[model samples]
Target: GSKVVITSVPRVMVEGFLKEYLSVGHVIGTELHTFGCYFTGFLTSSGLVVRHRALDDYFGDRKPDIGIGTSSLYDHLFISSCKVSLNLGPMF
Candidate 1:
């Protein structure tokens, strides 16, 4: 079985949009610190995109066959755990 997990540190609310737009089943993004309807512009916890801890929490008992990343260092935390990894480089 294969799974598409988007491990980013954007915001949890975006998970729904990404799931529908990209058709991915899982999303692991950072939780934004907010007060009422206002955003504090900071993370409630730590960023997930560049942290290996996020990967650990996301894929506890299972491992992905491949990992797609953007950098050699930051993204590699998630990439290195997979059987294979790909660096897509900068989006621009």
Candidate 2:
């Protein structure tokens, strides 16, 4: 079985929605710290910016068979590190 992991900087709360909507198995998004159920608007200690960290979280020491993303440099970095990569053009 292949696990679909979505990696991006979408709002913390929207991660789950996107995961479900996209029917992906997991999500790696920028997590925001909250206070008393209210967003503090600050990123948590482990923000998913650097691609390797997100990859470590999901893939550990192993790389995925394929990596897909937009044309941004960040995405390029992530996809390049994979065994195979596909660029879907710019997201914005």
Candidate 3:
């Protein structure tokens, strides 16, 4: 089996930034889907710890599906003027 690992700055920073953004409803246009798994976590100024495991008995032998897509207008002047930097590191 292949494994995927996603690492970022200290958990605290990620949680803080995400929490603040979520509170302000800044996360728009993304669909939230529900999965039959129990996810528990605790958050503090520095970070969060979460644990989630899918139940094997509930859905057996089926591969989990995941996908991501983004939409942007290339013709927009603002889009043409925008700049983004991609950092190949734990923090970006």
Candidate 4:
């Protein structure tokens, strides 16, 4: 009797392909503030740009502040940024 072996694709390779096919560039900038973390980068191959930010704290998770009056607004901005970046173009 004989047996056969199989191989599977690696996660990193898949992620790399997706990132490149998705036109995601190397993460060039990152900033973390009291409110959240901001990421900035350019899709080098397609010439598209992106800016992303994620809030550190959830709505009503902490004492209200003039700076944090509207958590929904920030959430919207973050979501829009991601959507726009991901759908900006068809990768070659």
lDDT of each: 0.70, 0.73, 0.27, 0.28
Worst 10 residues of 4 by lDDT: 1-10
- Distance from true location, Cα of 83 in model 1, Å: 2.4
lDDT digits (tens) for residues 40-74 of candidate 2: 87878876456656786678778888888889887
Candidate ranking (TM-score, best to worst): 2, 1, 3, 4
Q: RMSD of candidate 1 to the true fold? A: 2.7
The residue-by-residue lDDT of candidate 1 on 1-92, one tens digit each, is: 53466555575668778778877776776677889998887877664464466667767866778888877577777788877889898661
Error of 3 at 26 (Å): 17
lDDT of 1: 0.70
What is the Cα-based lDDT of residue 1 in candidate 3? 26
TM-scores of the candidates in the order shown: 0.71, 0.71, 0.20, 0.18
Candidate 4: lDDT of 61?
33
Report the poorest 10 consecutive residues by lDDT, candidate 2.
Answer: 2-11
Candidate number that wins on TM-score, 2 or 4: 2
Instruction: List all candidate RMSDs to the true structure.
Output: 2.7, 2.5, 15.9, 20.4
Task: List, residue by residue over 48-86, the lDDT tens digit for candidate 4.
Answer: 212222122222233212121123443334334321212
* Stronger candidate by TM-score (2 vs 3): 2
Q: Report the C-alpha lDDT of model 3 over 1-92, residue by residue, as the tens digit.
A: 22211122233234445546534222111122324562233333334211011212222454323212123221222112223322233321
